[model samples]
Target: MDQMFQIGDSILTVSLPVELDHPNSQAISQQIDEILQEQYIRGIVFDFGNTTFMDSSGIGMIMGRYKALGMRQDSIRAIRVNRRIYKILNLSGIYKVMKICRQVEE
Candidate 1:
């Protein structure tokens, strides 16, 4: 299992890898699915602090999770998003579906 996952209350936080390509996205999706099956998760927080690159697969992964959570816009979040990732997210229209934050709240 990937140590990137962290659970708190009903939320699942995923610390993404440096590069979010097809292989990485697929593995992350599978891991998140398994965790969801074992526990009731209402929201997902994607930590993109380390993610410098993301392909379309990453968008798909995020969208899949959003749908899995009943398509509630507030059920997904992106934290520690740098400028580059933010542009991608903006262009992908992900900002409309999930909350984006420049920093994680302590």
Candidate 2:
């Protein structure tokens, strides 16, 4: 699965692929970091509409980004997560740490 990222004026949206496993972790992390460094980012939004699988590494990826944004009083959000993924987020306590929305509005 290919990971794609898009940056808007107020947010960075990472369009994660079908599986967010180890193989794509480094690439996603590096791309996110680069985007963060290259922009005066206000927030990050993870679009999970197409994601079919995510393991603990995926949890770590989101947590890492959450911690990064916390330092600057910013935040990261997750959107369009299906029931299975929502359970993962809930079980990992990520739903408490980040906002999960039904959609992204401009």
Quote each prediction's TM-score. 0.95, 0.87
Worst 10 residues of 2 by lDDT: 66-75
lDDT by residue (tens digit), candidate 2, 38-101: 7777788899999999999999988888776764443888988888888998899987778877
Following a full C-alpha superposition, what root-mean-square deviation does model 1 have from the true structure? 1.3
**Residue pairs with backbone overlap in model 2:** none
Off by over 4 Å in 1: none
Residue range with the least summed lDDT across 10 consecutive positions in model 1: 97-106
Pairs that clash in candidate 1: none
| lDDT for residue 19 in candidate 1, whole number 0-100 | 99
The lDDT leader among the candidates is 1
